[model samples]
Target: MAEIIGVIEQLWRYPVKSTGGERLDSVEVDERGLAGDRLYAVRDGSGRFGSGKNTRRFRRMDGLLRLSSRLGHRLDGPELFDPLGRPVADPDAFLRAYLQRPDVALAREDAVSHLDQLPVSVLTTATLDWVRRAAPSAVVDERRFRPNILLRTPPDTPPFVEDGWFGREARGSARSGARLTFVRASERCAMTTVAQPGLPHAPEILKAIAQAHDGRLDALAEIAMPGRLGVGDTLSLV
Candidate 1:
């Protein structure tokens, strides 16, 4: 007997890999996961994926976070936005200016979703509250974790419930037939520490995740049954 664990509070789609995402009130999910998530990515002149992290010489990782990507009504169309949330005419120029890197360009990879991990990343407010208890000082915004689904768990539900959801299936609300299978706990990296829009530079956030949360903060999932998912949708273990 699967139980109603929580309601979906938010839905996020990242049109570009690792850039700011567009939050949605509702979305249609398919085998490829969210329709327009991570369909585009920054590629250097040589075609190497431009990503944050100084460790990867070919990737311009951090500055991309400063830009935000939104999907137009057409699932394939993505509009770039500046740090101030204004649509940019010359997105490439805006990116170059923000990143301070030349020869960088946005490229679309139709074959690949350009996802960092699995297709769906899920987390709960309960677990977030636990992190708040652990960190005490840092802001624990869900955006920092970049979860596609943000759930509001029932009171008394323990933190880290997602850790135990591995290999299990979860159904979305709205009677939409959506389903997802928990894959693995999402691992922490330098991206969590980098400053993004509305968030300041604070590497301590990662420290909190590592020291108290075992360096894992979210659960990655694969689509089980694709359907429309909306905010306030119930997510029940199935």
Candidate 2:
């Protein structure tokens, strides 16, 4: 039996890693997850990718959250843009100038994975609402989390509902026919506190998650069946 969980509230794709994303009504998904999500990333001389925090595979880079990237109409590749909405002629040069690191350049994801974790990230409206209530001062926008799919749970549903969805399978109730398997609880990160357009630098959001949820929120999933996903699609667990 499949139990209805919620409606698909929004769909997002981050064409470039560590930068802003664009909302879409529909998107194609496959084993690699969203078609153009994170196809490109800022690579440093050390081969580390740009990220909010430093790690073995990533280098902490500032001002990435303020920029945005989107796939071209033909889905060829991501086109980079600056905070002023100007199209970057040379992404590498722009990055070098913006970050003041001449060695850092824009490059496509090769053997290394650009994503922080799983291929797909899932978030719920209830969780966002709970974060808002828990951290009254912080801005709890979905952009902070950068989920590929945002499920809109029922109004009465409690927060952290996705915590129990691990190991379960879900399918969309629409013609696109996308299916997913919840793999694990997505751990919260410092990226959630990064400032973006219309969102201020708010560390309270992550602090609340650490205190209340042990630094984890939402679910990280993988595509069980490749297909299309659209807004307003009903998501149900099988």
Best-fitting candidate, scored by TM-score: 2
lDDT of 2 by residue, 81-197 (tens): 898778898888889999999899878888999988999988999999999998899878999999999999988899999988999999987697889999997788888998888
Model 1 alpha-carbon miss at residue 216, Å:
0.6
lDDT tens digits, residues 1-238, model 1?
A: 8888789999999898778998899899999888888888887776667666532323656677888899856665679988788999987887787777788778887554466668998889999888777766676688888889999998988888888889989897657789998899988887877788788776787887888777998789999989989998998887
Provide the lDDT at 106 for model 2. 78
By summed lDDT, which 10 consecutive residues of candidate 1 come out lowest?
A: 52-61
What are the lDDT figures for the candidates, one per model?
Answer: 0.82, 0.90
**TM-scores for candidates 1 onward, in order:** 0.93, 0.96
Cα distance off (Å), candidate 1, residue 232: 1.0
Give the clashing pairs for model 1: 51-60, 51-61, 52-61, 52-62
Q: Flag regions of model 2 displaced more than 4 Å.
A: none
